[model samples]
Target chain A: MKNWFRAAMAIFWKDILLETRTKDMLLAILIFSILVIVIFNFAISPTPKMIGFVAPGILWVAFILGGMFGLTRSFGLEREGGALKGLLLAPVGRDAIFYGKMAAMFTLMMVVEVIVFPVFAVLFNLSLWIPWLIPVAALTTLGIATIGTVFSAIAMNTRAREIMFPLLFLPVAIPTIIAAVETSGVAIRGVELAEMSRWIPFMGAIDAVFLVICPVAFNLIIED
Target chain B: MDDKPAIEINGLTKSYGRTGVLRGLDLKLDWGEVITILGSNGSGKTTLINIIGSLTKPDSGTVEFGGIGVRARATSIRRFIGVVTHEHLLYEHLTGYENLRFHADLFGISSADERIIIVARQLGVEARLNQLVGTLSHGTQKRIAIARALLHDPPLLIMDEPESGLDQEAQGMLDGVIRQLAESGCTVLTTTHNLDKGTAMSRRIAILREGRIVYDEDLKSSTGADGVKKAYASHSGESM
Candidate 1:
């Protein structure tokens, strides 16, 4: 157990350091997400009353789509010079590999979300006091990261992995995305964390199910 | 210490689509022994190496390493094995030092810095260790890959055509390194089409023909490449 944790942490830090050095995935993901928000700003002229309803959807669309892009390209790093083979050859358990990768995706997606939120506030002309939305978005991001990491791994060796990832990931992830949008809508409406009690438990349940199943699924995919 | 053979494979069979790669092949190596496998292209050398290293599962077979079942305990068994193949298996963006450090951490080595320095020095890549792997030449990258495989000082080493990209001097250095490792009681299994290097580096030579080992012989150290060339020609059915 100790070894597994150490190995997983090593992989996580390695991913972070590599991406930091190259600005490869992080910059591309951040730009595309902001581009998404900018494009939606022009397309959707929501009335003040409808802004609350539409902003969350647009926010999540940018988040999920940009995240999907990052998730799909993530494995290409491992695939390029066959770095995945080196990971497999290590003594680390397959579950450690999954968690390490999942944690990296979760962290990267969260970083993107942090930068995107204020831009979103400025563009949508809303108060940037949606602190409660962080937790809501976090729960949603965990679910997306779990599901996206697994599906990205599945599509890794495929020829058209970019297209295949969303096809496999989005359908399974709709429940989490819906929960994110709903809870953000609640948080954006100036409600306290206590008011999101209903949606929080639902998001928690979805994240729990994903956390339990995705790592085991990753093991089966790699070993078999 | 356990006294079983270092590696044991029985009735291993693998196929890809309609073409069979390994057909019920079997081979064994004892502790502290070295064996070189020679085979024609597409004759299952890589498949055999991959299966032994636990990179790929066999269609049907049982493989054991030091009395431990390979399929049942891959993660634990991996601690004692290191592999080098055609692929460099490296992250191009990270410096060579970082790549080795990452692997050392995964193998749970506490003294990662010292080990990385030692292996880099051994491979004559100490100067290039700080350079990104992508910026290095092919031979330099191959040397780094070799350094990564040796980073953990594993008991068993599986290499597939490891000398392909190396310069003549580096190849000679690798030959000496494998010899020294064998002398230090490591079990080495490698595949190469180069008969001279094969005969010089290993105590035993096995030739794979038609998905099976048709010839397995112990060398007398003075065994010349010309004699082994004839044996290889007869068994592997490739005109030398």
Candidate 2:
């Protein structure tokens, strides 16, 4: 058990080091997300009432698009040098690679969210300072990263990988995205946790199902 | 670790979408022997190595390591095998030292730093250890790939076309490294197109053609490079 955890952390650390040097995923996600927010800003009216009405959708869209970009690039790095084969050839368990990659994606998504959320709030002239928003974003990103990592691996070797990832990822992600947008809507309006408690359980359910299923699916798909 | 054969393949067969790669192939390597498979492109050399390395599954037959079937104990079998392919398999963003260290951690080598140093020095990559793999030359990258494969001291080393991009000096270094591994009782299976180098480094040579090993010979009786080349041409039906 200890060895498994150590192996997972080693993969995670390698990703962190590589990202620190290149910043490819982070930069791409950040730029694309910022562009998304900027486009939405111009597309929508800036009235306070208008911002409140559309803030959740815009915010979730930015997060999802940016997070998806990060997910796509995550596996691309592995494919570039045939590093996935090297990882698979190692003595480490396949689940360890799944966890490590999911963790890295989660971390990357969180970092991007942390940066993008405040900028989003400022741009939309809204408030997202509630503690509820944090958990909502965390749970939602966990679901995205979980499912996205699996599909990313699946699509990594495909000839049309860029087209294939979203086609596979978005449908499965609809439930989590819906829950996130709905909950974010409540949080943006400063509703009490009791009022949004219904959506929290649904989001948590999605997270639980995927957090269990994706790793197992990843193991099966990665093998010959 | 015992008196058993290091690797045994029995009637192995594989194909992709009606294109056969390995057709009823069988080979065996006793403990501490170095065998080089010589073949042209699409001749199933990589496919054979991949199956034995447990990186790919065969459509039929069995591969055993130390008398244990690979299908039932893949993870355990992988721990004993080190693989180097045509692809360097090193992360471009990470330094050579970092790449080796990461693989060592994955293999659970506690003495990773020491092992990385030793293997890197043996491959003469110690001086370039801190350089990013993407910025290094192909020869240097191949050296690091070799170092990564050797870090765990796996008993069975499998390499596919390991000499493709190497210079004469690096090729000489590779020969020495393979010889040293064999001397230390590590069984090595490598595929190469260079007849002379392959014959010189291996105790046995096999020519793979049309998805099967058509010619297998011991270096003892094969007089020199010319003999091996002629034999390869006759078996593979391709001029060297």
Candidate 3:
């Protein structure tokens, strides 16, 4: 048990070190999100009333698009030079590999979200920021990273993974995204924390259920 | 370890879709033996190698390493197994040092950098340790790959066509390294196409044909290399 956790941290640390050196992945996803915000700024007129009503929809569109772009290429790093095989051969548990990768995906996705959310607020005129959205974003991003990391590994095996990931991922992911947008909409409208609490449990449930299933799925699916 | 064979496989069979790759084949190697497998392109050499290395599972049959099942106890067995396939299995974005370090950490080695440096020096890649693996040339990368495999001083080493991309000096260094590892009681299973090199590098040569080993012999007699060459020609129908 102790060895398993150590091995997982090793993989996670390796990923963080590589990302810090290259900075290419975060840069690409951030650029895409910022461009979406810029285009949306030009495409829509953000009056006070319009900002309140349309902000969640526009924000989620940007977040989901950027998250997909990031997750699509998540497995590319492992696939390059057959490093995934190296990981498989490393005497580590499949759960360790899964959770380590999911953590890295969660971290990268959150960084993009943390940066994009503020940039998004400036453009969408959403000055009514609340601390309540932090838990919402955390739960929702965990769901994306959980499902996305699994699909990223699964889709990476396909010949046309760029197309296959969304085809496989969107149907499952839309529920969480919709739930996130709905709860986020409530927060944007300055609702009480107790009101948003109901939807938060559902989002957490989605993340919790898949968290257990994806590891088993990953262990079975992982093969040469 | 001496009481049991380092590797044992029996009634192993594997297929992809409708195509059979390995028929009910069997092979065994005792502790500290170096064996080389030679075969034609579609002769199931890689399939056999991957099975022993635990990279892939056979559709049927069992493979054991030092009394442990390869399929059932893969993770436990891999702690003492080092594998080097045609692909280097490296992270191109990480420096050679980092790659070796990460693998060392996974294997739970103590003083990992010290072990990595020792192997890097032995492979003559110590000077390029800080360079990103992707930036290195093929021979340099292959040397680092070799270094990575040897970093943990595993009891069993499995390499497939390990000499393909290496330069003459690197190949010579590898020959010496393998000899040293064998001297230290490491079991080795490797595949190669060059008969002369295979004869020189291994104690035994096994020729694969149609998903089975047709010829398995030790180089003990005066004309052993010549006899094995002739048998290889007859079995594989390929002149080297």
Candidate 4:
């Protein structure tokens, strides 16, 4: 268990260093998310009712689209120099690689969320300061990162990698997206946690299922 | 160090679609031995190395390391083997030092700093340690790849075309490194198209043709590079 954690952290650290040096994925996700928010702002008028009705969908659109961009580029550094092969050659268990990659993607998505969340609140004129918003966002992002990391690895080697990722990722992600949009709506409207209790547990269930499945699936995809 | 062979392959076979790559191939390497495989293009040299490195699966047969089959204990077997392929296998955006450090951490090397420094100095890459691998020349990248391979002090070293992009000095350093590893009782299996260099560095040389080893001769009994060249031509049906 200790070795597994060490290996996972090593991979996590490598990704962090590479992302910090290049800022490629972070910048792409940030720009694409900002564009999404700005376009939605123009497409929908700032009327309070309109903002309240469309805000959840727009916020999730930014996150899902921005996450797609980040997911597509998750393995870019590894593919650039065939460094994935090096990681595979290590004695570490395959689960460690999966966890490390998931952690890195989760961290990157969270950083983007931190920036995008405030902008989203300002643009939509919604109160996002509710205590439940943090847990809701964390749960939703965890689901996306878990599912996205596995599909990213699968798509990294395909010839139509750009087109392949969404086709494979989106269908599996519908449950998580629904949960996120629903819960975000509750948080945006300042609904009591008891009102969202049902949806929050559903989101947690989705996260739990993928959290158990993705690492196992990752092992199969990466094997010879 | 033990009586058992460091690596043993029996009836190893692999194919891609209808095209067979390795067909019932068999080979063995005793501990502390250096064996170089020389082959023409499409001779399945890289395929064999990939299988032994646990990066690819064989269609049939078995590869045993220290008498344990690779199929049953791949993860554990990987702990004992180091691989250096044609690909540098280093992140291009990362500096040589960072790349080596990452690999060391993956291998669970406790003294990673000392190991990286030693290997870098031995490969004459100490000066280039801080440079990003992508910005360096191919030969320098190869040196970093070698350093990464040696970081874990694996008992078995598998390399594919180790001398492909290296200059004379780099090749000399590689030769010295191989000799030192052999002296330290590590088994080395490498493939190269350079008959002269392959024969000179390895104690035993095998010529691969049509997915099978057609000719194998120990350097102790063979004349020199001329003998290896003639053997390769006669077996592979190609002139050097």
lDDT of 3 at B162: 87
- Residue by residue across B1-240, what tens digits does model 3's lDDT show? 568899998989999899999998889999999999887778887788788878888999889999788888888888889888888889999999999999998888899989998999899999999999999998998888888888888899999888889878878888998999999999999888778888878879988778887888888843599988999888876674
Compared with the true structure, what per-residue lDDT tens digits does model 1 show for residues A107-140? Answer: 9999999999899999998888778797898899
Off by over 4 Å in 1: A192-195, B221-224
Which parts of model 3 have CA positions greater than 4 angstroms off? none
In terms of docking quality, model 4 is high
Query: Total clashing residue pairs per candidate?
Result: 0, 0, 0, 0
Candidate 2: deviation at residue B44, Å?
A: 0.3
Error of 3 at B178 (Å): 0.8
lDDT of 2 by residue, B1-240 (tens): 477799988999999989999999889899899999998889898888888888899999999999999877888788899999999999998999999999998989988899999999999999999999999999999999999999999999999999989999999999999999999999999998778778877869988888877888887877556777898888767766
Worst 10 residues of 1 chain A by lDDT: A186-195
lDDT of 4 by residue, B4-44 (tens): 79999998999999999998899988998999999888999
Fnat: each model in turn:
0.89, 0.80, 0.83, 0.91
Interface Cα RMSD per model, in Å?
Answer: 0.9, 0.8, 1.1, 0.8
Model 3 CA lDDT for position B220: 89
Ten residues in a row with the worst lDDT in model 4 chain B?
B219-228
Work out candidate 1's RMSD over C-alphas.
1.4
Would you list the clashing residue pairs of candidate 4?
Answer: none
Residue A203 local lDDT, model 4? 90
In model 1 chain B, which range of ten residues has the least summed lDDT? B219-228
Candidate 3, A1-224: lDDT as tens digits: 88888898998888878788877678877888888888988888788877767788777777777888778877888898888888998888899999998898789888998888888888877774667788888998899888888899999899999899999888889889998888888888887678677898989898899899989888888865
- What's the TM-score of every candidate structure? 0.97, 0.97, 0.97, 0.98
